[model samples]
Target: MSEQSLFERIGGREAVEAVVGSFYEAVAGEMSLRVLYPEDLTPSREKLEYFFEQWLGGEPRYSERYGHPRLRRRHFPFVIAEHHAQLWLKHMRSALELQQIEREDFDSIWGRLESLANHMVNAHEEVPREPLPEDAWLT
Candidate 1:
């Protein structure tokens, strides 16, 4: 029998969207990683969910809309360092675990995300930027 595609093993578009939603929820809650997201996660979540859905083999919507991911180019403006990459992977790992996705599928997804995160690093030192106030709900 042919091996199942990662998308098939993970339950396709619906499942991937659920996982993305959960992962973003964790990101929205974290202090350090929160800044990577916009003030609202709705748009970001939609983009990622669609991206993964196409990437994992569900549909071509992402590429059709965005015309090549160009993940690094899109993320070049962000200051992702080793620590941030680790934290981002940590949350994603947790979300996959919580979804009860198979280990192999999880590893595959993590490996891609880790690679993308590593490539997203644009600066060695953190750039000076205004800090979010304690009461700020959005990063």
Candidate 2:
């Protein structure tokens, strides 16, 4: 239900953070998505952790600290394409699967993640830029 908080459904901040950390770990090693993350994912992880905390219906820390998510605006500088989206989703799915979250809960979380990933795309060009090798692998 929309009224229910994400923290409650996902097992609170600790659980969400664990899932995110797992996802990032996979992302860091993934050649296609390694560059998507910054040199340090600590802040990024914290932000998402807080955002999801509010998004699932708990507190509104994300909006309170950052104002409108403006996700697209924030990701405009990145060269996200179909390949990148697919790869990112792969890692996320893997992480969720590893977490062994309930099927229904996994679906809900994956649906939102899919929408957000799709929304982050900024380029449709045939020849998209490549991520730096060092940056491409999160590891």
Best by lDDT: 1
For residues 13-77, write the lDDT of model 1, one tens digit per residue.
77888888899989989989897777988978888887888788777777777776766656555
lDDT per model, in order? 0.76, 0.73
lDDT of 2: 0.73
Which numbered prediction scores highest in TM-score against the true structure? 1
- Candidate 2 per-residue C-alpha lDDT over 27-55 given as tens digits, one digit per residue, 9 for 90 to 100: 77887677767888787778777777887
**Cα-based lDDT at residue 74, candidate 2:** 59
Off by over 4 Å in 1: 1-4, 125-139
TM-score of 2: 0.79
**117 in model 1: Cα distance from truth in Å?**
1.8
| Pairs of residues at least 3 apart in sequence or in different chains that clash in candidate 2 | 6-56, 28-138, 28-139, 34-136, 35-136
